[model samples]
Target chain A: MLEINHLRKTFGRLVAVDDVSFTLQRGQLLGLLGPNGAGKTTTVSMIAGIATPDSGHVLIAGRALSGDTDPAKRRIGLVPQDLALYEELTARDNLRFFGALYNLAGGALDRAIGAALELVELADRRNDRVKDFSGGMKRRLNLAAGLLHDPDILLLDEPTVGVDPQSRNAIFDNLEVLKGRGKALLYTTHYMEEAERLADRIVVIDHGRVIADDTLAGLQSRVAAAGSPPANLEAVFLTLTGRSLRD
Target chain B: MPLRPLTAMVRKDLQLFFTDRRAVIMSFAVPIAIASFFGSIFSGPRGNAKPATIAVIVVDQDESTISQAVVAGLEQDRNLKVSRTAVDDARERVRRGRTSAAILIPKGFGDAAGLAFFSGQEKPALDVLFDPSHSMEVAMVRGILTAHVMQAVSAEMFGGRRGGELVDQTLAGLDSTSMPEDRRKLLRDLLGSVQTFYRQPDRSAGGTGLRGGLTMPYTVREEAMTAGTNVAYNGYAHSFAGMGIQFLLFAMANLGIEMLLERQRGLWKRLRSAPVSRLSLLAGKTVSGTIISLMTLSVSFGFAMIVFGVRIQGSLIGFLAVSTACALMAATFGLLVAAVGRTPASARGVTTLAVLMMVMLGGAWVPTFIFPAWLQQATLVVPARWAVDGLDAMTWRGIGVRGAIAPTLVLLGFAALFAGIASMRFRWEEA
Candidate 1:
């Protein structure tokens, strides 16, 4: 459902993302695992149409994202690291606003807002202002906003950052449900356990390059063949990306 | 374009604006409070009250008829209060500020007047003492004394004249025996002309005409010529309206900065990611800003009407048309500010400084007439000035609908220019 070819972005003297390429099919949760400053957010931002890559081709549903932005944007949803909910508005209002942005209104908009809220288990607290919400509740609402549009593909950048374990588990369950419904998701995170638990195909990136790309079991089997005692995805990640401090 | 998203944005903006109590108070309450305070101070009469209170000491040394009349006349004047006291007491009173002026009438004051009347060589004069600190009161007392003497002289000269006897005597003195009937008729006509002069009152009081004494030293006549029609100008109302409009523009710009904040927070991105187009988002903000600005102007006008008695003398439609243009111009200005600025702080700083400079140059705080001639010419570049001038033309100039057309067009031009720049430079993300 999504493909990136030879993506390159530079900021003055630093090359943020260099020659990065990946592909994901329908009903697949592709984990983009990277440490800090690994250009994960930059890649996600380009795919989300928030940033322009210096040289690249981003294809979503077989349409070039750069040339046909509206169609590509329509097919994708971006859940940013920060909860982008309006603090002064209620969760329901926030969802309704985002839903209208996606051209859903009246009956359909209401239904979408209700369903998204219920999916995040925030239906009961939909009427409360986001400013009064806890960190976990706000993160859930953020996830709900992305789902309100019901796009074909969802791109999440560290969605579990700063969220509680329960909320993180709920997010993983929601991702599984989305996958079951034949939706494609590009989830970026540094936690190997999250990639092992949720990602159908794990693409480990380091220093703006894709170092390893394989299914969780396939990567573990390869590591075990190297006499690594059937190493888990964590050992495979460390072996591929290394453990250097990325500051 | 879908309006639902725009409506949502407007609703969110209003909710955020109302949630902050400090913003509400600063935006609406402060202006009303200041307007009321200034309105009250300027509500009363134009002139200020007299500060110095004068007291006059009257020494009745003569106790004569003329002296008593002079004292009574001085007592009747509101400026001077009369007090009967000895010379020593009067001097002490003057020293203590109890008395500003003192008059001494000698025992032979009536004899002196009679001698002065008959002799005409040496005139009798009264001694007047006054405190030098009260210079205005001293001058007033001197004037009163001169007037009193003049009245006494006029009464003594012409009070007992019988007009009929004088006419008869004058006729008897004419030489009728040497003249023909025709010549006698001409002489009679000449005598009639002389009689008309004597029938008129004395011209010594400097009364050239009834209106002559009513003329003031400096007369300020304000005639506002809007579209070639002369109308009475209300300077205060024009100033208030101009300032009100300029500040309303500022408030609307501030609201637009809030929109930029939403953009920074990724709210705009989230909205754009939906089915809504960029045009709808811009339209929504512009419409919302314009509506709020117009509401602010209306409320300010309401205050102006109730407090300053400002009346809209021109066509209401024309006023509204110009005001709407002004609102659009303000909104467009805000958009330009937001589109050009990369951050909310920069947007606020630039908008505030720019708006203030425009208002100052536009004659919002000060009337354009008071501005230097060159500065007034320079104000044409500022859109706020055009708005203010347009409003003044509608209200104080009473130029009707036609007067507003020019300013309205200028304001529309400004709005178009600003919106064009904003549209071209607008970006969804920080650069």
Candidate 2:
């Protein structure tokens, strides 16, 4: 379980994340949908313990991780938007390195690596350097690296952005399995279909503020009440955040 | 914080450093190549195949026979190159670094009142125009001039014609001062002994008696300050000390660039997100850099001992202590640079220039004794100076722990200062 309470972040005169708040229980997935420069990554970054919140709190089952580095950070696994794998190292070595940072060792570490690689469908190619792998294969390996530590919660930002359709579907199936295992997941994406299929609930953000947050039916009803009857999360998101170019 | 993750962090970094051929070449290979280059350049004793000749511009205003003879004597010396020039031109030449010194023999130098040997008057002074920055060169020029003066004074007092002139002049000027009876008698007897000594006849077939000329002007007696040492002022000791420490700092700063790149590449962000403390991350890089520098210095000094004939003249333990301290200073220095520069490209540029200046000011290429007084004092702030001095002491100077204490403590103090700056400024993530 994770909690982001009134989290806000600013870069000079610009507010990147303003009073954004959310909570995710075990076995639930929360899709954070936003256009470019809409603070989706900033809010997720705070939850992943990667960036400091200018104000408010990021708590792991009510334990704060805001003071630079704290032990509560071990409970969260971050799959950043960028591929964070070491290009020179094999996929297996990358997993071992990140796993060691979480204090995982011996057979438990090996088993975790094996399971993560298998789940990502890259277990057969685990010994190959990440640089030599395809974009989709590297994405799989990147996801597998974060899963090596078996964290209580996972914060994945655009996890399938550059992956092929098959790899994207594979990532979808893997998230399903992780949700079934009762792990809290925060998934951020620009793809409406992926969020529609994977997320149980969606929170739409724009310009550093959460404009709408509800279950699929609840959001559609809100959009319907706003003059036009919206059919899906795509119409709900566009109608609420506006159709103008965000940039 | 536990050491496990910190150790893992260091191991991962070292693995990356070794696997990257470019890093390997920059860190270890380049230093080896440079060491061999310096070794060959300084292959001979005193670092050159032939001794450098000191430039002497003589301003001979007194063109008497005695003054011309002194100028000729300076030309005949092996270590000096003599040329005649005006006083202003010679002074300008020395000022412009074209010459080491200028010898000014004023007017009336060879007259009876000017360094008048027979009359027992005060010796006239020859002004030496020299660059104060060129300490070794100035000392050599002064020493050569002093030797020349001693020889000329000896030659005048015991030579054929000058010897007779001295006795006549001394006996003639005896009553000019109106001294006490005892003092006058003492001076007369002393002059009488000299006259009798020069009047003696030459017995050998090839002998030149006192009036002919004194044959050997000066003789040297050599001794070692530290007896039974493996080296004695050869270029190898200075070579290893200079180039070894110089490249070690360079390699250390380059290692710090790796840490800076980590911040740019987002690896530092990922590491910070881990359960580990930020101190552990900083410590990991510091430890890794220190280890690399130590291994680099050890291999360098080891090869220098076998190939360049550099020895550990003092306690090996003391040498180890100084080496370790310097390695620590280099580690902290790299961290401080990474913190200050904050980016890979900027860190590389700033650290390279900084380390180069530190090595130059550290007296690595040139001996500290040869540096100007102010420069020598200013270079005390550079930790590499302590390292070079400490290594030289343990290798050639042979003073042992007592000599190592100062350098060791100073290096540790520098390490602390660099570490303090790093802790205050090191950033976990780019803004």
The candidate that wins on TM-score is 2
Kindly report which residue stretches of model 1 are placed more than 4 angstroms away from their true locations once superposed.
Answer: A12-14, A65-72, A218-225, A230-239, A242-244, B38-236
Complex DockQ, candidate 2: 0.44
The runs of at least 3 residues in candidate 2 whose Cα sits more than 4 Å from the true structure, single-residue gaps closed, are A11-13, A65-71, A163-166, A224-235, A243-247, B40-230, B429-431
Task: Give one digit per residue, the lDDT tens place, for model 2 in B13-99.
Answer: 777767778766766667667767766675544423355678889999988655666787889888898899898899899999898
Cα lDDT for residue A234, candidate 1: 81
RMSD of each: 11.4, 5.7
Scoring only chain A, what TM-score does candidate 1 earn? 0.95
Candidate 1 residue pairs that clash? A101-B274, A101-B275, A102-B275
lDDT of 1 at B159: 30
Evaluate all candidate structures by whole-model CA lDDT and list the values in order: 0.75, 0.79
Candidate 2 residue pairs in backbone clash: B159-B211, B160-B211
TM-score of each candidate? 0.72, 0.79
**On residues B1-431, what C-alpha lDDT tens digit does candidate 1 reach at each position?**
66677887777667666777866665566666655554444333322434234678888787755566567667776666677889898888887877788988777674456334422434667878889898877998897776665444334222313322333344454453355678756756755654554456753443343211122235456433533443333454565666677667777777768778877776665665555566777788788778777777787777777766676888788889989999899988878877888789988888888888998788777667778899899889999888988887777667789889998999999999998898899886421
